[model samples]
Target: MVSDAVGAGEGAALRARAVGKTFAATEGARVVALDRVALDVGAGELVSLVGPSGCGKSTLLRLVAGLDLPTEGELWVGSELITGPSAERGVVFQDPSLFPWLTIRRNIESGLVARGVLRSQRHEVDEYLRLVGLEGFANSYPHQLSGGMAQRAALARALINHPRVLLLDEPLGALDQFTRMRMQDEILRMWQARGTTMLLVTHDIDEALYLSDRIAVMTPRPGRIDRILDVDLPRPRQRNDRRFLEHRARLLELLHLTGGIEEPLAPGV
Candidate 1:
């Protein structure tokens, strides 16, 4: 069950309007990484971005995190324009990136400490540790934990700030199948408990179907949102259900998989 206290606050809405990004290549050539992408994640909504590699999914996520600014257009968390990184938007990448010298508790507390609020918000350290099921590992070093456990610790570190939007850039991509599945559920639980809006970037179509309220499919390089599909399945969705299979087929078709294209019948044939 989700903790009422964690789930109590309202989440911030996220919007990307005509968002574009460009990069400079050799010989002063310009590469368009993203072009006129528009997206929205409602407050507390879990949205996933899925596409082929180099489609700028991670780039778009970085812009949202304010790690990088969009070359053109705008991004917003609630009504405030996003200019740079803020604690309100926390990011977790594929790597846990925990400091080897820091204990789980210390790593989780690092965010609060950086903001000069550790003295006042110290109690949240324990709360988040337990929230991620890491209460017993607080004193353990990062090197002592498994990959999944380390990622959980990373998640707790981000959540301790009570971020309004959590940006996940393939955070579960490195886990083995079983562990990945388990972590998916763990992430969902945390999302519900905290009501934090989430924007997840993943290559796994099944993962997007299983975890997101909607999935935005992007085109190849110079990425653009080709389609946005709503997942209407109920919570704890069944992977083997007919509707689930139908949705999977559709997405695969959009990605040009399954080989067969739908062609209209010739008139009077």
Candidate 2:
């Protein structure tokens, strides 16, 4: 079962401490992207990071995904220290990033192929295709599917690896409003089925409210987690309900979008 939050114990599936990243700019000067960021994502839990542009949300995610190394601090998945990319951590980005030449089925099998286990896991491909509601699209190439369908393909591809932690960097951000909402439900359904610990970086507060068990708010630059708000509402939350609106308002206040006087913020991008 999913816990409320990660704690001092071993329930934390993902953990970061004093995490920081800096890059050498064109000049001799350096740019500090993240500063003393600390967070823990419990096993089988869904957590989201919400902040304005250039807050290093994606940078932190890349660190967790092992795509980049932090200039400071420690990152851990289970008891293992993060050193480099591994099949154990799956990632899906804003763009689907599928191979155009391959069919959906082959694309999903790509992970198994890379691990030299296609012979054993070939049968799991169709099951994952079905899991993502793309069983019929298996034979279709990336160019043949709609935007949402291609994303479904991408989801299937990442999930086929069965990573212990899934890092989502605005995977649904590019979709239209309707499609994005539908995909949210799809993600929830899959999460329930797999119970994979997921960390999402989203600019959309409502999306974070809808998907996350907890939301981590961050400062604009030299990013640090400003606060973490627990989503105490029941599962399958209603967007129009009073509790949902209250949480939205609080998130807006934290994001500095709401004035001292409260105002209605428009939903969706």
Candidate 3:
């Protein structure tokens, strides 16, 4: 069973406290990218991280992924301290970084192979491929597929690992509107099917509201968690609902308060 720390069902899940990151420039100047930010991703939950440009959303994702260590604070995944990248946590970036020379099936299976799964377990790969709606594209190479298809393959690759948590860094950011909407549904379906804990970083507030149980709003440089907005909309939420619109307006108001919007403030009309 998945630990409660990660989901709603059982086991205490991942937690981070006072996390921060800083970088030193070649010019001998120090840059602070994140402040003492704290967050918790309960098991079986989809938490979307949304913020203005340069808010260090992606940086925070990387820190949670164990790609980099925080300059301060603590991060724990299922009682384990996050020191570096591990198979238990999987990440999908904006671009589908698949190997062009390898067939899609091989690409997805490669991770399993590295983890020492028996050759007989190769069939597990197809399940993920189908889960991502890429059943027919298995034999195709990365170059032969479109952006969305390649991303599907990437998703299959990540899921094949059966990681306890999935970190998505703007995975659907580059798709066209129609494609993006479709992919969002696909992702939600997969999340329901697997019950995997997910943290998605996105600039689109609408997308966040659509996919997340809660949305974490971050502040500009030296990023901090400014707010945590719970979405109480019932399952299968409709975009046109009055409550949904009200929530969106409230989020926009918060974003504006944090200087995320730059439009001229009009007099109450």
Candidate 4:
């Protein structure tokens, strides 16, 4: 029962061209994190980046979040080149990372307060809380809620800013399996309502398959965009359906997760 999980008209086009990121390591050596990576996410779309450990998925997210600078190439949000972090792009990390001392209501409004606009924007706080299904918990402290609830609050906090692009770095990774599944549905709900573009980083293949409009598979360290596959399946995808399993098997082969690394490659369907 997922509505096509796309954003309304709230998203801004995102583009990255020949982007590269490198860091200095020990012994005067350097480590390249991302290399010649190029990608695009159309307005209101959901795209996922998936790869093995140390593959720079998070690095790419950080660059887009404006938390770090790239060594080469360019990144853009709609017409503007990304030179630094802006309120138009918001991020939710694996850790919800809510403040221990603040109530959910205060946490959600913290951003507005920081921007010195809380006085003018306070009326919107309750709306965003309800948007994430956290209205009843507004007064609750971070420790008073369960992992799933806190993540919801964190999501609400980010959404309240009306970011044009939402970056999710394994936001549901800490939840139990059941909670994770439920949160997936919740994410779709929010996406449809806000129409805000989303770029997600995840290790879960099924999660990518179920949520992404397209999946960008990255190579190991010094990560490159090895390939991007369109998910042509219909909404409310059945994880056990024939096509679903076929895509899953193909993805496993692409990632070398299956026992066969020599399997002939298939073009994206």
The candidate that achieves the highest lDDT relative to the unseen native structure: 1
List model 3 lDDT by residue over 1-269, tens digit each: 11122223322257889998988855787778889999998987999988777778888989988999999999998889999997778899999999889999999987787788838679777677767777898899999998998888888888777778899999999899899988998888778777888999988888999899999888777789898999989868787889999989988988877767453432220
- Shift in Å, residue 3, candidate 2: 23
Q: In model 2, what are the clashing residue pairs, if there are any?
A: none
> Would you give me the overall lDDT of model 4?
0.87
Q: Per-residue lDDT tens digits of candidate 2, residues 1-269?
A: 21222121222399999999997876687778899999999998999998867778899999999999999999999999999998878899999999999999999999899888899989988788877788888899999998899998888888777788888999999999999999999888778777788999997889999999999988776788888899988989899999999999888887784121122422220
Better lDDT candidate (2, 3): 2
Which ranges of candidate 2 are over 4 A from the true structure?
A: 1-12, 257-269
Residue 136 in candidate 1 has what lDDT? Answer: 95
- Compare the candidates by TM-score and give the number of the best one: 1
What is the TM-score of each predicted model, taking all chains together?
0.93, 0.91, 0.91, 0.92
Error of 2 at 32 (Å): 0.3
Any residue pairs clashing in model 4, and if so which?
Answer: 7-195, 8-195
Give the poorly placed runs of model 4, Cα more than 4 Å off.
1-7, 257-269
